[model samples]
Target: MREIFIERRDRILRIAVKEKGQLYECFIEEEEERNEPLCGEIYKGRIKNIVPAISAVFVDIGHKRDAQMNMKKGRTYKQGDEVIVEVLTEQIGNKGAKVTEEYSVAGRYAVLTVNRQGLSVSRRIKDERIINNLKNELVLPNDVAVTIRTSAEDTDVLHVNKEIDSIYEKICDINEKSKYILKPQRVYGENSLLHKVLIDNINNQTSKIVVDSKDDYELIKKYIGDEDEIDVILHEDYRTMFDYYGIEREIVSLRHNTVNLKNGGQIVIDKTEALYAIDVNSSKNISHGNKFDTAKNTNMEAAYEIGKQVRLRNLSGMIIVDFIKMRDDKDKADVLNALRKAFYNDKTNTRIYPFTELDLVQISRRKKGKSIYSYIEEKCEACDGHGKRLKLSYIENLIRNEILRVEGENAINDFYIELSEHYEKSVKGDIFTFLKEIEGITKNIYLNFVPGIDSFKVEPLLFKKQVENLAKYKVNNIEFC
Candidate 1:
């Protein structure tokens, strides 16, 4: 059974999708993004600068920075001319948002495009009857286009038609606003996180929708009112819905580099600036008798996991997977087939290529918004993105050296080393030996465990009385000689 669990906390909404009680996907929406227009929003922008060399223009879209857009072929826009634009990507780092002149509004089953005028269907929907039916059924205004989403396949005509009408109405509204709104600003935005989760994930197989927030429960209940088959439940447990459903643990696992498979195998996922690389390792899989059999089985398991990880992490662009080497050609084919089947239902446009001569399978997935890591984790300030930190032993040695330097200057004996409580506890045993070694050198070397300090700090006190006075308060986790 497919179930969606939504939990709102700290002005952030977390949505987790589970199939048969196992986590399938997870999404987090911050409050700022929920309330403000970011990506996938239509705006009325004025051309600020036109770089003819690059064939791109910068437009003032009322954001902190102007958005960058590629010039549409045959379309000329002078400075100060207004144009309707859609945000294709959000402002990332030093680069401004990437916008497109061709504006489109997405709905559950259809996307209404204001610039492109034609009826298009999702390539994933292959049924001739469904394609023909959608082509004939969806009605749009002249000069407007609509693309039938894959979710519309085998859907009720009424549902698809209703969504089309809704999206077209939104397009009309945005267009109307663009005409009168003098300043560059957003005209239309995508629906809320709840609406998106329901539209994109809740299908025939989805049996239950659970939300911890009462307001969210009502909103979801009202949105899916037409569908009586799906049950919307309000979780009343004291624990957050994610914790109750084991989704919190699953979310934490996403931060790790290694993922364990059920068959005593593991897949190590590494992301570089250029592309993502996944390596499959067959460990302790003795159930398979032969080497070829074990390689194929582990590769198959990794293939399925790769599909899930890509979606869960929102890993986009080029991805290469190195699977266990198998001699049999048929085994490779079977693994590739299994990989294709795994991504068949993915919403993103993912293409899996045949294994290369180097025995690596390449995949290219459409770039979406930021990956799950961007939302859930931040780069470690200490490591500076290198994913490593200074060893506690090294830090202890550095602190000892600093004290020795101070001792050489014949400084006051009443000295205190202030460090974070966490760091202090880690090196507490070493601190005892160091204090004994320096007992004769310094009258009283004190240790102060500041709550939020990241590293150890050494300071020389003028008088022993001062150290005694500071220790009287006992506010910090301080240690005495």
Candidate 2:
């Protein structure tokens, strides 16, 4: 059974899909209140410059950076030409948003393509009769092209044709209004995440859809529109739907570098500036006597987990996986085949190449938005983004200086110092002595320990004035005292 859970977390809407209790996919979208740039927004952009050598053009789309459009062969563009484009991918790192000339507006049943001429059906639907019916029966405008989506399958023929007609008319209205526009503008913005999730997966084998917010539940009901097979549930329980389904735990685990497989194996994922490196590790010896069989089994497990992790984390760019060494040619082929099959359900464009001479598998996936790591984790200030800390004595001296500074202020009766559990253990003796000295001066001093915080905080209990003294001291790894 498939279940979808939607939760509104502050200004972000998080969606998680689970199939038979395992997380299949997850998405994070900013709420409309935040007014963030979405994936499917259409913009009328003016061409700023054309680089013929690269076959790419830069356009001013009212974003901080110019959007890039990769021109196809025989396609010509001139400066100051106003072209309508859709955002293919959002800005990543220093690169601008990737835009495309071939724009598509997606509806629940079909997607209307502008300028691109072709009637295509989703590859998932294998019924030739259904494909032939859609191809022959659906009527679209001459200029507009339509692609029958997977959701169109098993749906009423009249409903599918009506939806196609409605989307075509909507695009026609947008084009008619665009004739009067003189500058760069947005032609259309995609629907909210809730609507998008329902539209994209309504025809799938989803048995239940749960939303925490009543407003969003109503919105989803309106989008589903009289479809009663799928249960659209409004979860009014105090516990969130994510918590109820244990999806929150899975999301939290995405931050970890290691993933444990079912068969006593693990995969470690490391993200660098250029690419993602994954290493497969077998924790226990296989019960099977044959080493090749054990390696193949572990490699197959890693391949499936890699696909799941890539989707869960929304990892993109080049990925290199170091699978357990398999000596047999057939074993290598089997592993590669497993990897390809695992990514069949992925929505993003992904290409997997065979193993290299060094036994590393190379895979490339389309990057649509910020990675999951960047979304959840921030650069550490104390480590200066290196993910390491300075010497213990250096931190201790920094703490001493902070205590002295607070003691000199004499504004409050008590002082509180908060440090991470690790740092607390390292400086316990020094902290005790410092607290005793401060107690002599102010008659009240306290030390608190917190987890995961490398730096320490010093504050006056009465005045409520806190000072982060780690910044005032320079980091010296070599110096001890």
Candidate 3:
């Protein structure tokens, strides 16, 4: 059975879709802290400047940075002219949000476009008769355009027409209100996360919708009103919706660098600033009969897993995958085909190229938001995220150098050296042996241990007269230095 589970935890809303008990898709949204997604939101923007060289213009939309809009042919605007714009993509990293003069409002069964003419059907719906019938039924104005959605294929003719008309009415209302707005402001906001999910997935096969929030459950009920065929249940159990469906475990597993396949193979996913590199490795013990067959099977398995991981982690931008080597040309073709098929259901726009000369498969996906890893994990401070620290021997050498430097002065009767617990424990024997070498010069070498210290600290012992003169001095928690 297909089901969608929604849960709200600590101001974060998590939604997961399952097909036959396996997670197919997952999404997360911060309820209290994050700004609502700006994509598909309509705003009145004032053009700030026009860059003729790049054919793009900057507009002020009340954000910290001005949004960028691409200029089309035969379009002209002054510096202070106010125009309607829709956010195409949210601001990513240092780049500003991308906005467009052309905008469309999407509904469950169709999308209405402003100032454009024609009815276009979703490419996924291939029935010529259904397409023609939808085209004939849609009665829209000459200036307005509509695109029939795939969900309209099985919907009733009256319902489809009504939905189209309803969306057209909303568009007309917006146009009517646009003339009265005097300043740059938001005219329309995109649908809520729950509403968008339901609109996108509510079809004939959707069986159940489970939610942990009673208020959200009631809101969904109000949206669906009389859709009794699809059961929208309010989960009252103590276990979280994510835990109940094993989504939490699945999400946690994606944080690891390596993912193991069922056939004993593994794929290592590494993300860099420029691109993501995925390396597929085959196990030593062959699961399949021949080497080529084993490589092909592992490549095929990795292709599907790679697709799932990309979506689960919300990874975007350039990606390169290095599959297990296969000798036959047919094997390479089959693996590429498998990868293309795996991303067929992905909502994000993705393009996969054929294997290159270096046997690498390249992929590019549209980036919308931060990846799941960045949201969940932070950079380590100790090793500056490099995941390695100085060796104990190196630290010991530095300590010895400091001790020798103090002994060179010829004024120290005794001295104390502080080291981290880890360094002290690891080099206890080394410290004793090194002290024996300098026994004649200063037999009063003192070692002190401190917690969480990354490097060594040195302090020379002062005489009784010197300590009395510096009344407020303390050394290693002792009264006298």
Q: Which predicted model would earn the best lDDT? A: 1
C-alpha TM-scores of all predictions: 0.78, 0.78, 0.76
Error of 3 at 76 (Å): 0.5
Off by over 4 Å in 1: 31-37, 388-481
CA RMSD, predictions in order: 11.3, 9.7, 14.3
Best-fitting candidate, measured by TM-score? 2
On the 0 to 100 scale, the lDDT of residue 378 in model 1 is: 43
What TM-score would candidate 3 get against the native? 0.76
Window of ten residues with lowest summed lDDT in model 3? 472-481
Backbone clashes in candidate 3 total 0
Model 3, CA-based lDDT: 0.74
Cα lDDT tens digits, model 3, 1-481, are 6788988765567788887787777777765324533667777779999999999899888777788999888887799998778887878766778998877777788888885788788988999998888777767667777788888999877887788788778777777677788777677764356666777777777889999888888888887778888899888754456655677667656668898999889899998879999999996538778888899999999998999888778889999999988888899999999998889777788999999988999999987656777545544434456653344433444454455556666666566666665544444545455554334234455566678885567666677664444333232233221
Runs with alpha carbons beyond 4 Å of true place in candidate 2: 31-36, 190-192, 239-241, 388-481
Compute the lDDT for candidate 2.
Answer: 0.75
Using lDDT, rank the candidates from best to worst: 1, 2, 3
Model 3 misses residue 293 by how many Å? Answer: 1.0
Lowest summed lDDT across 10 adjacent residues in model 2 is found at 470-479
